[model samples]
Target chain A: MNKKFLLLLFSLLALLVLALTPFIGMEKIPFDTILNFDSSNIHSDIFWRIRVPRILIAFISGSALAISGMAFQAMFRNALATPFTLGVSSGAAFGAALYVKIGFIFSLLGISGQTLFAFAGALVSIMLVYILSKVKKGFPVGTMLLAGVAINFFFSSFILFIQFISDFTNSFRIIRWLMGGFEVIGYSDIYNVIPFIIIGTIIIILLSTELNLLTLGEDVAVSRGVSLSKVKNILFFATSLMVSGVISVVGPIGFVGMMVPHISRLIIGADHRYLVLLNIIFGGAFLVLCDTLSRILIAPAEIPVGVITALLGGPFFIWLLIKSSNNNSI
Target chain B: MSKILFNIENLSFSISKKEILKSLSLKIYEGDYLSIIGPNGGGKTTLIKCLIKIYQSPVNKIFFKEQPIEKIPQKKLASQISYVPQINETNFPFTAKEFLMLARYPHLSRFSSVTAADTKAVASAFDITNTTNLANRFMNTLSGGEKQMIFIAAAFAQGGEVILLDEPATFLDPKHEHNVYQILKTIHQETNKTIVTVTHNINSAILNSNRIALIKNGKLDFYGNSVDITKNNILEKAYNKKFTFIKHPASEKSIIVPEVV
Candidate 1:
């Protein structure tokens, strides 16, 4: 089949899945109430206020994580690298834990204090990784990966320390928040995250050619007329914002970033020009499917969406490892 | 009599307190095909890197077209010179055409796709390098000789005035080694481009280049025409060995026969 045609088919399938997901929940929403288009219809309230926002949040977060993952992988030249590898999620978890421990029961402009602190923590860790990655020469991939793992462990220990000090209720809340899920009530949360997703995606897609050059290595990228520092700086800032933005709202969903890009690379090629858009579609659909399954698997008892993702992604990751080792592809 | 294309004066470089290039100076003119030959760890590759500013030479030391290299933007510099490293390996699978298309990067706009002119240049490069059949083949799957051909084709597609290569024929059989140099020789004879290559294969360098520069311990041990390079015991001093110089059987050119002990 023609590659473009295959892409179009996948895109339409994704759209269909996105459109059909809101109707298949635990409680039966009346079809007429959905079609009624009334201001106070209970069914319409469920559709718009509850289901649509949840679907939108899942799609947005999934797409953001996947795209950021692809960029991080290419930049670091590591197949296993993800947006959260540099302790972004752990930093956010630490911040959220600290917020809970401090007894701050405040909300600013509908944004919780935990979300703000989590984003701040993510930014700090990202800066540290960025600085450590820079040697006298340009960014070294090995050092970046090591520094990321180091920061990740460092922040994780602090998070454990925070949890140890917090009281039961605060600790419970913090733990629940860390197990990411999509329980967004209305359109406001979706609206808040959509802008960051759009801007970050656009900036990254525009530099897709440069990203392709980077896959050839840094010296080749420089010889090909790519401004290494400029491209790296932009990508770093963009991926940082996207990861921080989504994790703050969704509370650090795991493996969606790594799994989605690798799967998309299998279906599509490694050309970032095409890979970026395909990843967005596949990632969004993958999360929506996982989110839907999480809600419906045991009705009235919700599994954290993070658990579903890891459960699905873990096997696939193992299969990838075995396949690569078998074929000596890595 | 031609104007100088590249001028180096008092160039020096160091990595982690160890100097790799000393205050070496040389002048290369327009349309000069120069090959640099040296033993291992003699700063031959580092000299090429310094010439291309990959090692970040000092201010006002290295000049291209009589202008300080630091003053030129990366795109403009890439437009003037192209580099082919000794080992070119990409972890991801890119087709030969796709790999060559990157050569046109310095010439393309930020948002535009590959244009007709770019395609034409790539096609011409394939024809010139005899790599038309390898266009759709994955670069990683290719043999060393095929990959070297594609690399040279890509560098040609870069359309730069100076094409710098480091060990263009490394890791290849004798037939492919000669074939690689033959293709480079054709490019030099057919165009006004200045070609600079650093290689350990002294016979191949002598067969192709117009001028030769022999480096030893980060200094220029010898710099002259290839015909004049065979007279001194420079190779023996540079490599700490004995060499037997003989005339080529067919062309009567100077060729070195290493007297292996």
Candidate 2:
């Protein structure tokens, strides 16, 4: 098959899955809810207020994580590099844990204190990493990774400390959120995030040319006229914003960001223009399917979507390692 | 009668008190084929990096066509001088055509897509480097020599008068090494490009470059026409070892051979 045609077919299939996901849930949203809207439209209420927003959030947040993952992988030139590799997710988790443990009653713009704190934590961790990298003459990748690992350890210990002191209910809440969930969200909750995700993803797509050159190496990219520092800084902030926004709301979903980009690369190759778009489509569908499975697997008892992804993603990751080791293509 | 294209004057670079380049000065003409050769860790690669402004130089020290190099925007400078990096493996598997298209970046605007003329340039670059068949192949799947040729083709697509190459044939077999040099020679003669390459391959440099720049201890110990290189004992000084030159049977270029005990 032609590569373009194959990509299109895959995208359509993913879209079909995404579209069909809302109707297959526990309540079985009436298929005619879209075409009929009377005053006492219970089906319309379920479809519009709950199912639609849940799927939209799932698709948006999933794509956000995946797109950011692809960008970070190129930035660090490491396959394992994800948006969370630099401790962004850990930092957010710590903040959310702190908020829950402290029982913070404050809310900004009807947004919970936990979400606000999570965003701040993610940004602060990235800022710390940025500052650490600036101590060197060039922003060396190895140094940044080491610093990120250090910060990740630091935040994880703090989160554990918070968990130790919290009451049983608060600690349980914190643990469940950390495990990741896509629930109880409406369009108003994500209205602001939509703009940031759209803008960030679009900007990354436009700079796909530079992203392609960067995979060759920093020096090669610079020699090709890419302002290395400018591109790096822009991508860092954009990726941080996107990742932080999703983690703040959806609570740090894992595996989708790291695994989806690699899967897309294996399927479509590593050109970011195509990779980014395909990831948005395919990655969105991937999490919707996972979320659907999470809801339906236990039937009225929901497992965290994050756990479902890990359960599936773990074997895929191991297979990738074995295949690469056997053939050494990676 | 070629005009000076690059002028380096009293330039120096250091990292944490460790000097990589001293107060070295040299003039490169518009269409000169210059080779920079030195022993390992003698700053040959560093000099190439400095020339391309990867290591920032003083405002007036490095001039491009009599204008301060720092004044040129990165995009404009790239269009004037493209670089071919040493053959290295890439984990990302971009096709050769997609990889080559990145060379057209400096000519492109932020939001615009690649156009028909850009495709023509890429096609012509493939023709020059004899890499048309490899266009659709994944970059990581190609052999080292093939990858090197594709990079050179990318440089040609960059539309630069000056092409800086860093060890273009370091890890290739003899046949591929000769093939790479032949492609470079054609680019130099036919396209009228100023070629400056850093190489440990003394014979290849001597055969392909019109002039040689010998670097030692972060300074240029010799810079002259290739024919004039044999008139001095600079090679021994540059390497801190004894050397002798032999004539190539066909090209008649001097080949440097080390004295082994």
DockQ of each: 0.53, 0.59
lDDT of 1 at A52: 88
Model 1, residue B117: displacement in angstroms?
A: 1.3
| Model 1: lDDT of residue A314 | 74
Candidate 1 B-chain TM-score: 0.96
Worst 10 residues of 1 chain B by lDDT: B85-94
DockQ computed for model 2 against the true two-chain complex using alpha carbons: 0.59
Error of 2 at A173 (Å): 2.9
Q: For residues A63-93, could you state the per-residue lDDT of candidate 1 as single tens digits?
A: 9999998998788666566767667777766
Candidate 1 lDDT (Cα, whole model)?
0.82
Lowest summed lDDT window (length 10), candidate 2 chain B: B85-94
- Which lDDT tens digits does candidate 1 get at residues B201-233? 888778778899988777788999987777778
Predicted candidate 2 versus true structure: per-residue lDDT over B33-148, tens digit per residue: 89888878778888888777787776798999999998988889998899987776654467889888988988999878899988999999999999999999988788888888
